[model samples]
Structure formats: structure tokens, C-alpha cells
Target: MNFSLQQPLENESVKLVPLKNNDFDALYQVASDKDIWMQHPNKDRWKKEVFQLFFEGAIQSKGAFKIIDKSSNEIVGCTRFYDYQESDKSILIGYTFYATKHWGTGLNPSVKKLMMDYIFQFVNRILLHVGAGNLRSQIAVGRLGATKIAEESVAYYGEASKLNFIYEIKKEDYLSVS
Candidate 1:
């Protein structure tokens, strides 16, 4: 239970830091853009109220982070690991969003690598839930070598939505890849 919780994970390609107060302006700028949240479960489309609510939740949960570009020192996106069920020895990694520019590049792979590497240090398994309709995310999860386990309608943002696929990777499997 004494897990070392820290922020701002950095590697050669990207930096994953806690979403702090200073990130408000930058996060709000990108999060407020309608195009960013189009495929997201939260249909609010990053509106002011939605962003506020999201940030508040993130702060309270203490499980999210802002993705920063080390070279340019710019905020490129956000990702997090939440809903930790210690009794089940499982945790969920979602609420990820990256700027259009960061998409398609190896940035995501590198970020995920860092997160998974860190997470497996203490947990036995990790779960990723992707919207079924989001092919991009689905493929990403598959590329991570996670096996799809099930699908269900879960409440996200504010409503009960269907087509959420749950993918899981055990510690042994993760070690094989890492």
C-alpha cells in the first residue's frame, strides 16, 4: 500500500507531469476546442463547464497528468490512471487526449511505455477501457498487447454510454514486452 506516487515522468520523447494549477490556461485552451472531444465519451466537447468539472475531478483524484513536450516545453495532451481497485489488484488507465499534432507519431507509444513500465512495478494487472467506436484508440490498445476482455455500457462524463471495450494486461505479459 505504500506506493510512491510522484508526478512529471520524463523520457527521451515526452514528459508526463501532474496536471497542476499552472496547466490551467494551456489545458483550457486545447480542451476547449470542440474538435478535440468529438470522439470522446464526454459529448460536452470540452466546454468551459466541462473542462472545469474534469479538472476538478482530476485534482481530487490525484491520478491524472498533463503530457508535455520536453523539446518545446509545450503542453501537448493529457492522460491518467484512475479508479484504482486495490482489492482486485487492478487499475484503469484512460482519460487520455493528445493534440492533433502529436497523433500518428511514436509519442503515444513512448508515453504508454513509460506509464506501463512504472505501473507494473507495483500492480499485477492494468485495465484500459476504450470507446468501441474509437478505432484509433482500439488499435492503440491492441498494439500495446492487451487482450480485450469484455464490453459494457458505462457512465462517462455524465451519461451511460455503450460500446466500451475493456482490455487487460497482466504483469507477466507486460514483462514479456518490456
Candidate 2:
């Protein structure tokens, strides 16, 4: 079977559904908080126009998801599975952000665990690109046992390139982590 990035993924805490055009308002509700983007590479993404472009790119990726809080049944964040490298047998999981209210909770890892559990079935490695200055995300990925392998320039879908730290986790390593 072909690897499908937008497939519905869920665990006890959250559900990741394939993003759709109509999901704009709901997702924007979660993303509009300036604090949500404070540590993100695109800090002003909370604005309507900027987020519109970001949302547009997400739609085009065909791999984006609107994350939902299972208990509240409300949109809480967004993430994606992108840049699948066939030759290297790897896929990237990134463009992730969660509502500030969810921060410091176990939601991030819970969400990542669900994604890793699903994606590891199809690839040997998973990669993440975090903004160089985004300490929050860097620490989160580190907790997942991903090592910072390199620093490189990563251009957003339609935006300029920015410095990013590439973190990688091998399937064997992730599996061995308790």
C-alpha cells in the first residue's frame, strides 16, 4: 500500500484528521493566538493574511492534518507529514504547533507517539526540521530521542528560506526508547 500522510490517526488524547478547505476557521481559531506562533519561525503567522497563505500551502501539501482534542472535540493544532525521501527510506514530520493551553502537558508527546507509531510502519527513519531559535520544539524533539544531525536552510512552501536544525530518529532508536 502507498504511504498516505493524511490518513486518520488517533490515540486516547487526540485525533488527527485530514485537513480540508472548510477547516480554515476552526484551525485558525487555534492558530490565531499570537502566543502560539511566538516561538515559531513565522511569528506573524497569527495574522489572517499570513495564515491564509500558510493554510493554502497546507491544503496543497495533501498531507496536513487538523489536530483535535479528543475530550473537547475542538481543534487544538496542526501538523503534517511531508518530504518523504524514498531513496533514504525516510519521511519528515513537522509544521507542528499546538494551542498554548496544551503546552507543558503530555499532549505533544502523545500526538507524536501516535504519528511515530503509524509512520514507522512504512519507513526506517523520521526527520523533523525545527527553527534554529525555537527552543521549545527543539527540546520536544530531543525528548523523542531525535538527534540534531545538521543545520540547513529550509524554505517554507512559498516563503523565504530560514535556518533550521534537522533532527533525525531511526526506527530502531525510537523503538528502544521507553
Candidate 3:
């Protein structure tokens, strides 16, 4: 079976729509906040020049999504599914960021559950790369039952490599948790 990464996904709280070339401004508006990328590997992503490269990569990836708040109908963040390895039956989900307002509102897990529910139908495991210093993301992934299995220097699209912790969630593990 072919795996499609950009399929639209949503729950009662948020929606994931295929990101378009025209979405640069809207997504950038949410990402412009300095705090948003403070702990991210590419801390300069808040800059237009850097973010343009990131957005270009997302567009080329063909698996990026713009996250929208259902109630406000506003673009709150962006995420993507990338590096799908058929041999390993695994995929990586990262490049996720949300507005500060949604930080502790259970939206992350909901969005993750939505993605996992859909992708688990095609793959056996989902891997995530969290910035080494990003304690918030580390905690969040842990809460979703993902385990830190390794550390490596990961290269961001059109950016320098940075130390990152790899987290894994097997289909069975996610099923048991959710």
C-alpha cells in the first residue's frame, strides 16, 4: 500500500490541511514569535529568510500541513510527516509547532492521535526528533508514550545540523496507550 502523508486530518479542536504555496504568510504569522522557535533546532526560523527555506522544504516534501483551530478558524501552527521508510515500515513526524495559547490545551496529543490513527494503518512505527534542549517537547512526547531511544545530530532543511533526541512509538505501543 502507498502511504500518503498529506491527507487532511482533524478532530473537534484542530484541523490539518494540506499546506499550499499561498500559506506562507499565514503560517509565518503564527511562527513569527521568537519564543516559538527558541528551543527548536533552527532557532532563527522566526526570521523570514530562514523560514522561507523551511517553508520551501515543506512544500517540496509534499507532506506538510497547516494546522488550523476549528473554533477560531485560524492557522495556529504547522507540522509534517517526512522520511517514510518502507523497508522499516516507519515514518517520522516532526517540525510541529503551535501558538503559545494552545501549548497546554491538550491539542498536541489530539493532533498526534489523529495523525497516528491514520498513519498506523500503513506503518509499524513513528519516530520523532526532538531538539536536545527542548524539554517541553521531550515531556510532551513522553506523555504520548514515545520513548527516547537515541541521540543524534539532525540536519534541518536548508539549515545546519543540531543535536537531537530520537523518540520512537511503535504501533502496538500507541495502540495500548490510546
Q: Sort the candidates on lDDT, descending order.
A: 3, 2, 1
lDDT measured at residue 9 in model 1 versus the true structure, 0 to 100? 82
lDDT of 2 by residue, 1-178 (tens): 3779898999988999999999999999988999988878889999999999899989998889999999999999999999888898899999998999999999889989999999999999999999999999999999999999999999998788889999999999988874
**Candidate 3 residue lDDT tens string, 34-84:** 999888878889999999999999999999999999999999999899999
Clashing pairs in 2: none
Clashes of each: 1, 0, 0
Candidate 1 vs candidate 3, lDDT winner: 3
Q: lDDT for model 1, on a 0 to 1 scale?
A: 0.80
Runs of candidate 3 exceeding 4 Å displacement = none
Per-model C-alpha RMSD: 1.8, 1.0, 0.8
C-alpha displacement of 66 in model 3, angstroms? 0.3
Each model's lDDT comes to 0.80, 0.92, 0.93
For model 1, what is the alpha-carbon lDDT of residue 78? 85
Candidate 2's TM-score reads 0.97
Clashing residue pairs in candidate 1 (N, C-alpha, C atoms within 3 angstroms): 8-17
Candidate 3 pairs with clashing backbones: none
